[model samples]
Target: MLAILREITIPCFFTSYLIVLVLELLRLLGRIPGRGLAVIVMMTVGLFTHVCYVLLRATSIEGVEASMLATWLDWSLLLALALAISFFVFYLMRPDTIVSFFFLPAVLALIAFAVSVRDLPPFTRTEAVEVWRNVHAVSMAGGSAAVLVGFLAGVMYLVQSWRLKRHRAGSALRLPTLETLGRMNRRCLVISTVAVGLGLLSGVVMNLNRWGYVSWTDRGVMLSLLLLVWLLGASAVEFFYAPASRGRKAVYLTLASLGFLVLALVGVLTTPHGQAEKGAAAEPGATIESTTATTVIEETTP
Candidate 1:
């Protein structure tokens, strides 16, 4: 892990990005062939290599700084790795799809963010604090993973909706059938919610019982509440009316939820002071001490 300039990850990223770009281009040019075992094999390998890079970075528990840069890079790596795992592992049960075209750009954006945020001075903490910090890191990473799945589901819904509305006949650019995308969307939504719930709950219990006075407030919590409200409201609407197709509603809800996520992220990145440090005029709520969730940006109104 000390050797960050490894050839494996750099070449692997190039290979993976190339495959995805080439595949999408072929589809756009109306020349995409049906699924081939060899193509999947190459994709799997490339995905594997990049994922290893993500894992290596994530497991670095020696020193952690709760600054915007560190948190963003860590969460992005977790998300990229999670998505890679999901895409490859699920491909076997599911049919081939070109959904990566939509997702890859986001992946690249996060990675670019990771690279841009450099030069963080490492901190030394007491053992208890270190243990608690790991707990918070794991929880926050888990939560962010959930959010990523939710975003993907939203994109899938939009792609499916566009195709149906256009009434386009079968073509290379044609996405997964509406039914499959809907199912996948539902799966992501459900799983993501479960993870969020687990992460949030653990954070609450750990905070409320052990250290109750350290509670903090910021835009992050507000945005999370808004997202939760949106999801719950959306689900209620679906359950009540049972729309003709969940596609449109799902798309709208997903886009709005993703907006909330972006807002929260921006709020975190733009803080005027140091990272989430205790006795630093900020709340400790930025990172969960004992859960699997993405850490919210650490800041107080001040």
Candidate 2:
């Protein structure tokens, strides 16, 4: 059993979520007996296996001083884990609701992306600032999760609005009402704004501590700051300036702000600095330097 768990790959959980998503779509067409039970069981199993994969990855960091997540793949998996866990809880709290239709695709996509980048060079551990870096990474992960939830809520608002406008009254429609979705969207935007703001602030401090000065021009930094500013501006407008127009306007703002966040994240993953392993304790047996985050690590023999 332990050996089987050890061999579990990213596709395992990805496939499981895919199954749940399919089940959800089927449920939307007609009520299938035991569908809710099956979805709950599958999601629970998937979440457990996903946790095991994360633990196994942590064990692989034998020599690194960093936290379990050391690369873009690691961060992506962690973010997926957060979403999976959130979905699992939601499933339990609201059974037969098919909310997974909104979230599972993104989870699967992240898992797929994580698998694609699993071999990328890791961000090496800086012993002096390991804790700070971990905090920064985790905070950003949390902020990203909030943004994702906000995006889903916004989408739900739009769909519910369309359904209502079309006068499609049916017992099969298990979506949250427009008012509920709007409130959730607004709340999630506030949460995303505050969380991303704090995460960016901590990231700046971490960079300054590691490099003696922050890399303000770095693509990732600039893009993330742009996202932060956009979110704050949207939040300000939603809450203070135009509380009356917070319904459809808030939905658009959330979606637009999430787009900026995704763009920033992609920029981070594609940048040269993102591919290099830097900092002290930088992956032993790899070429490294003291001044910049340009240390490339050649693949090692198993």
Candidate 3:
């Protein structure tokens, strides 16, 4: 059992989540009589395995700073873990909510992307900025999760609206009321916008302290700004415009913001940090370590 848990990988949890999603879909189609105990059991097991894998990764490091998330891969793992835990808790509370259609596939994709890019070097942070980096990373992860929730709510709103328009009593019976979906969508939007806005501000502060300037043209920065702006604008419209079809409009805007967020994530993961010290070992004279060592030696001699 120990060995199995130790060897547990992302694919292990990914497959488990896939099965859960399939089961939920089956239940929704009325092929199953009730919210089966099987779905909840499978989801619980998957969440357990997922957590084990993350803990294994977290303890893999060996040094003073080992406790901190050292790389983008670690951050990605945390993000997926957050999403999974939230989903599982929500599933337990509302057994009939059919959100796996969006979240399960997203979890799978995140796992695939993480595995594909696992070879990238981990990000090393200086002590001066490590605290702020953690805050920014966690805030952004929260924001991304909120956006996903909003996106799912939007999708539900459209489906429910369509069923009502067609007067499809059979389908509408399975869906939440439009008001419920709208309230969820609005709440998620507000949370996402606030979290992301704070994240962006923290990033700016970190950059100013470290580099004395923020790179306005950086792809990640530009896309994140675009996402924030869209979220804020959508919130304004949803609250103030008083349009009858505001629900549909809010859903579309949330989906658009999610798209921008995906782009920003790719940009951040692909681009190496400017502070990253690559190939410095080969060019010994220019390494930060060597410079510090020399300074220490000179001070000792004097």
Candidate 4:
């Protein structure tokens, strides 16, 4: 089983999803017999292989027992997996919709980014804080996935609203109702806020366990704090400010959240946010090892 999983490389699932995307595009041009079955088959294959790849990477070896979320490569791949699963669910729910056209691209982009950072060193974590780190990683990834869903819903809301105003409601291109999209966006915002808030709190616990103090100057920390603040503020507005709870205002809030998420991701990738030198353990007195790894940011945090 491990050998089979080892052979399931990025290209395996990537190609499957790429073919699925192409098939989806072709569906737009005209009808193809068995197209729906073909899409389901391809998506299933892609998802299976993607899950296998993630599971393989997430296994703990003798010395490298830290959670897979410690490295950018694995973290990005996990994020992509979450998005792919969401797309698969959405596709199953509305096979004729053009949502996959937008979703598959983001999945592919995340895979590409994972490939780009595949060589970076994984962060080290002690056994004591492993569970907490996993919580941090999973919550953060879930929050990110929710943000992406919200952004997509927001885009769909805008497009659907435009179509309605322009009398294109009866067009072949089908989408969810504006009200449905708004509800989805609102739900996603709430989910993202809660998940990200949990992630941030877990991160703080992990930091305090490992270093005894949190480095507020860390770029990743600052950006994450900023993101959490924005999410909280957006959620408050959507809850307290009745006018912003639905429609275009709600959509705009989600769009802005995506922007903040992008900036935070850029900071994480450009700096050693969750990563540390090879062989370093999360000991209270253990100092962080400086690395020659080239990144967009050269400054290191202790």
Candidate of highest lDDT: 4
Question: Which candidate number would show the highest TM-score if scored against the true structure?
Answer: 4
Looking at candidate 4, the ten consecutive residues that score lowest on lDDT are 287-296
Candidate 4 residues 34-84, lDDT tens each? 988998999999999998887676553333234334678877887898788
lDDT by residue (tens digit), candidate 3, 68-167: 3445666577677667776786677677687777777787777777777788776543442566577888889999999999989989888888888898
| lDDT minimum window of 10 residues, candidate 1 | 61-70
Could you arrange the candidates by lDDT from highest to lowest?
Answer: 4, 2, 3, 1
Better of 1 and 3 by lDDT: 3
Off by over 4 Å in 3: 1-128, 171-173, 273-293
User: Model 1, range 1-69, lDDT digits (tens) per residue?
Assistant: 557434465446645756755665565566555534545776677676776665565344342222221
Query: Would you list the clashing residue pairs of candidate 2?
Result: none
TM-score of candidate 1 relative to the true fold: 0.43
> Candidate 2: lDDT over CA atoms?
0.77
Off by over 4 Å in 4: 1-125, 281-302
Count of residue pairs whose backbone atoms collide, per candidate:
7, 0, 0, 0
Ranking of predictions according to TM-score: 4, 3, 2, 1
Q: What lDDT score goes with residue 296 in model 2? A: 33
Residue 88, model 1: Cα distance from true site in angstroms: 32
CA lDDT of each prediction against the hidden true structure: 0.54, 0.77, 0.75, 0.82
Backbone clashes in model 3: 0
